[model samples]
Target: MVAYGFKRWFSPQIQDGTKTHTIRGHRRRHAHQGEELQLFEGMRSLHCRKIIPDPICVAVLPIVIISSDLIDCGIAYIEIDGLPLHRDEIEPFAVSDGFSPDRLRGIAPAALVASTARETMGRFWRSTQPGSRFEGVLIRWRS
Candidate 1:
């Protein structure tokens, strides 16, 4: 149902045509799913100032835009299950635990993350070094 190593631009509805209903696509997509106990309660409410205890999931890819090994200005991330997403490499960090997360809604957000979709474009990812912190638990979405 989801096999985008690159090529998806965007989608939020499900339907084809001929009176099927539920077809959505404007352009903008990426993917990833390798492991999970469950993540995305809305990215666990976006929290992470630094909560290290047992980091090391290393499945990467939550965001990407073609910067390469970021941190030049301090803007590169990858803390899935702990929410830090902002580095895509053919975005594919949510299949082993894929359900949701990596959405853009009506498309419009870039005060931090960027994209080009190759799964987002030129990825190397970052984050998770605060003593290798990232065991899990940071997805929050309540609405």
Candidate 2:
């Protein structure tokens, strides 16, 4: 499966490019009857009403992503399937939209990767962690 994340530059005047990320990690499991494909839009899920499909083929599975197009909230968006659905689509069913952002909060597990920024990302998720269920943060509304 492949996923891409896009981030908007905080300052439009600057020439900073959006972050393009390829989804990594997470082994296939039988739980949810192999039907439990999930996505987190930063701290919030797109909404509960949104039903997602988990593909059986690994060579070409659906790419789930989380991203935000709204820049004012400074909220990082999470996109699953690269669909254009907004917060309104999932608000009715969303369970924890208000939860504190943990995307960059707890990275202690990445300590062994060294303290440098480049090494940190490399160590934390340059490659997917074994047994981990989710992918690392990709596109932040701003970061």
Candidate 1 residue-wise lDDT, 24-143, digit = tens: 122253222232211111232343122112112223333222233433423233443344555452244321122122443234233223442222222212231233222322221111
List lDDT for all candidates, in order.
0.25, 0.28
| Cα TM-score of candidate 2 | 0.22
lDDT of 2 at 2: 24
**Candidate 2 lDDT tens digits, 1-143:** 22221111111211222221224434443122222233222223343221123222222223333323233222233345555347554332111221112222343343423433223333333243443234433211211
Decoy 1 TM-score against native = 0.21
Q: Candidate 2 at 58: error in angstroms?
A: 20
- Each candidate: RMSD: 15.2, 16.2
Question: Model 2: C-alpha RMSD to truth?
Answer: 16.2
TM-score of each: 0.21, 0.22
In candidate 1, clashing pairs total 31
Q: Predict model 2's lDDT versus the native.
A: 0.28
